[model samples]
Target: MADTPQANPQTARVLSVSELNRMARDILERNFPLFWVSGEISNMTRAASGHWYFSLKDSGAQVRCVMFRGRNSYLDWVPKEGDKVEARATVTLYEARGDFQLTIEFLQRAGLGALFEAFEKLKQKLQAEGLFDETRKRAIPAFPKQIGIVTSADAAALHDVLTTLRRRMPGIPVVIYPTPVQGKGAANLIANAIETASRRAECDVLIVCRGGGSIEDLWQFNEEIVARAIVNCSMPVISGVGHETDFTIADFAADRRAPTPTAAAEMASPNREALLNTLLQQQQSLQRSMSYKLNRYMQQLDFLARRLLSPAQQLTHKQESLAQLGTRLQNSMLQLLGRQQEKLLRLSLNLQHLNPNAVLNRGYALVQTRDGAIVRASSQIAAGDPVNLRFAEGSAEADIRSTAKPD
Candidate 1:
């Protein structure tokens, strides 16, 4: 024998419990992919940390399962013990306990898998056809004159909607088109009622609503006929079906989606109290503006009245001005007459000094030739010339004496 192949203690491989468990978990995770499992829930416990601990078992086997808070928080409904459910999970081993387990990513009611698949398929088809395009949606009237409703006559949803409408706006008229909202042929009847409302064209807006229920109970709204009818309706349509957590195909096709029937009525009507408040504010503003304008106009009228003059006062002022002008004219004329008289007296004195007859009266004789030329010098008279002499009062005719030079 080859010395019995003695093992070396220093070279032998050994693993701790934690390392072994970790290796097993990695191996299980790598081998089994995430997959769906269907079973009844048992040993359900909701931890204070919001995590869920449970066991999924069938008739033959059971497995430990855990769903973290992040995963279960998005679920609309809570799962309970003895509830049949489907889980999508991955296989793993708990490192501390050395136990095999599953970590769940999603959970749903056991039989709803087919329904969810159908809903997703239809949603994708309609989206591809542009049925859910925002451009195709109509605008909801802010003040609808008339409202129309399509629902079962006996539905509690109808009562809720009517009460909301009446409370918000009682003056607006509401027309109801009774139709079946559930059961075998409910989709076709709802479509007919919508089409009838559209043809009549009596309402500014339409509401199609029903109360909350399970997915199966609300499945009629997921039909193609109802969606097409909502898309083709003449007026804007508001769809309020099921609770806030529930959604149907009609919600996508409608102009607006409400969480409940009461919300849909609120969307279609305006509040009377709010409108009255706005009107009151506007009326007060108008009254203040008018009062300000009237006061300003009255002040202007008073100012103009002060500036205005009477016809009699105007005539009296003109007469006073005319009298003053006449007095000034009379003074000017008297001064002019006195100046003219003084000028005439000076001229008369000058003329008297230049008169030849006045010189003759002062012992001087005026001599002239017979032809009437006055003799100014002794040289102008000749010894044989005939001459005439005139005094201030008489005239004499004589032969010229001899002329002599004055010594």
Candidate 2:
């Protein structure tokens, strides 16, 4: 292949691969800058230098791509093998390798709306399986004895959560279950950490947290497996994965969702001032109730004392009334006795006028039989029957030797 045109003397002076590659890169960059390119990624590799190398391919051809550490560090999403992505890149050269490549400045999932749609579909599928059920969610302890933190140990989110917890509730133990928060295998690692924390039963509540990021950066929390682990964990979980508006599957799966790391700490802690205020109000109400009851009892005592009358006073009043009654009773008895005596004398005189004994005393003689029966008729006398004669001065018994009947 080198013999035909490259054999010529003039053609031997042609630029080296490095020189040509550099010139091509400069010209391409000058012409097309900060432009977007859409393609499927292949052969993706992340080097120890934190740089990314990949190939962008379509049905027709493929091109080498590079994302230096500086640009790669700012990327929210890392391209994976077979992933379709759009990159804001600069056409440049790899001088040492003498290769033409695209140096990416920014990278994002191609067709973000499509990605979101796929995400939603997966979320719905998991939800239908009860993976997002509220019943399955563990209750966040009102006061967690120990808080288990699931995040990258080196992440700023960890420090934020720690600092906030220390400030809000001092002496509360924090158990860190460090895991990979981003990049490859991060989702699996985070999911396992959650499961481990739950299985161990070392913490009362689990906080799955991370610093703020774009949607792609927070994608691990949106993964189905990670979300499932969070929902299935026995421990009460609180998700503080991103800013206030950022939401993920993990957030939906957690029993409680906090907007930020600081907010999560707040949720786990009680406000000292609020508790104190409540206690004070209760004490004051008790005091008021006691005072009211005491005052009512005191008034009752005062009323009882005012109504009380000494026995001596009651006896003196009764005795004074008794003396008046006794004097009036004596006068009434004397008047009644005088009237009764006068009435009795009049009755005796009237009775004397009515008595037959008075007539007898005036010189009436009465005859009586020996049986003490007066003989009014001679027919009442029997022969040899005894008779009695009565006189006004004295009555004497006389026996009638014979009875005579008037002829």
Candidate 3:
């Protein structure tokens, strides 16, 4: 296992090729614990049996690594040629070929680990302060009247954002708050630009953005000051600082996060064609509402017209009612007079029937005694000697000597 040179046969014990290989493997495995190796990938090969074979090398040295299906199947990502990566592996020599190699259990791309660590730390810190909370984030304007851009003037991201805005909505104005997006002191400049944009309040929304780059190139956006500036911006801020796969603290702190500068422009600007269509729809809706209100008013007018009356017609109706009442009163008076006349005539006939002249006409007579006494009895006539008699029409005087008795 030590790869010692062959000793003289006079006193040395010999080892077979297989024995040598086996001992070497045991010694290598025992000498090295699991360790990380960083290098670029080269000559990568995948066998039909799902085993990966590759060499990790820098300018000075190289080592072969084997990642079998069992371990690799759990990996979310795979390495490609020329990609810088770190492998966690144990050093071993293959027993069959006596080749020294590494048995890799895990692999990760290089450079990202440090950046990712910083990203997560800032992200969590800002999140705990409610910077990334949905409730605290501002809404992206559906249609920005004016757009403010905070990025380096020479950056391709500015061009991308400008081009996208022009394409989507040409008439919308854009204000650029230029700042350095890389190198020393760039983060402070970016933060100052964001604060300036917020203070100016010239645009409806703000886009803090830059072109894609390596982590170091985009490091300005990950700074705490830049993140705080984004959080403190008066208008909604859209972050488009890197490629889609790249993320930064500003992205988390922004009101809205866009994957790229062009995307940020698209997010902040409304499409003119789409706006035209929407305006058409709203116009049609307004017309419909006006039409409905007009129809309702027209119906009310018709109802009022039906209820309305001309003065002549109103007067005619009232006069006709009055004439009907007058006719009824005249008929009532005539009936009352006729009934009274009939009653009077009937009373007059009864009075005539009870008249004394009428009773005399029926041959009734009256008699009186002389000296103003009537003599109807024989005893009274003998004493009186004289009597007066009256017929129905005249009066007469008579004397009675005897009375006559009649049954």
* 264: Cα error in model 1, Å: 2.2
Give the alpha carbon lDDT tens digit for every residue of 38-79 in model 2: 899999999999989899999999999988898777654556
Off by over 4 Å in 1: 1-78, 84-113, 243-246, 316-407
Q: Write the residue-wise lDDT of candidate 3 on 157-269 in tens digits.
A: 99999998888899999999999999999999999999999999999999999988767788888899999998889999999988887688899899999988999999999
TM-score order of candidates, best first?
1, 3, 2
Write the residue-wise lDDT of candidate 1 on 290-357 in tens digits: 99999999999999987876888778878988889899889888889889889998998888999998
Top candidate by TM-score: 1
List, in order, the clash count of every candidate structure. Answer: 0, 2, 4
Worst 10 residues of 3 by lDDT: 375-384
Which runs in model 2 stand beyond 4 Å of their true positions? 1-111, 159-172, 308-407
Candidate 3 all-Cα RMSD: 12.7
Candidate 3 ranges beyond 4 A from true positions = 1-80, 86-108, 128-145, 154-156, 163-171, 183-185, 199-201, 213-217, 243-245, 266-283, 353-360, 365-407
- Root mean square deviation (Cα) for candidate 2: 19.4
| Candidate numbers sorted by lDDT from highest down | 1, 3, 2
Candidate 1 clash total? 0
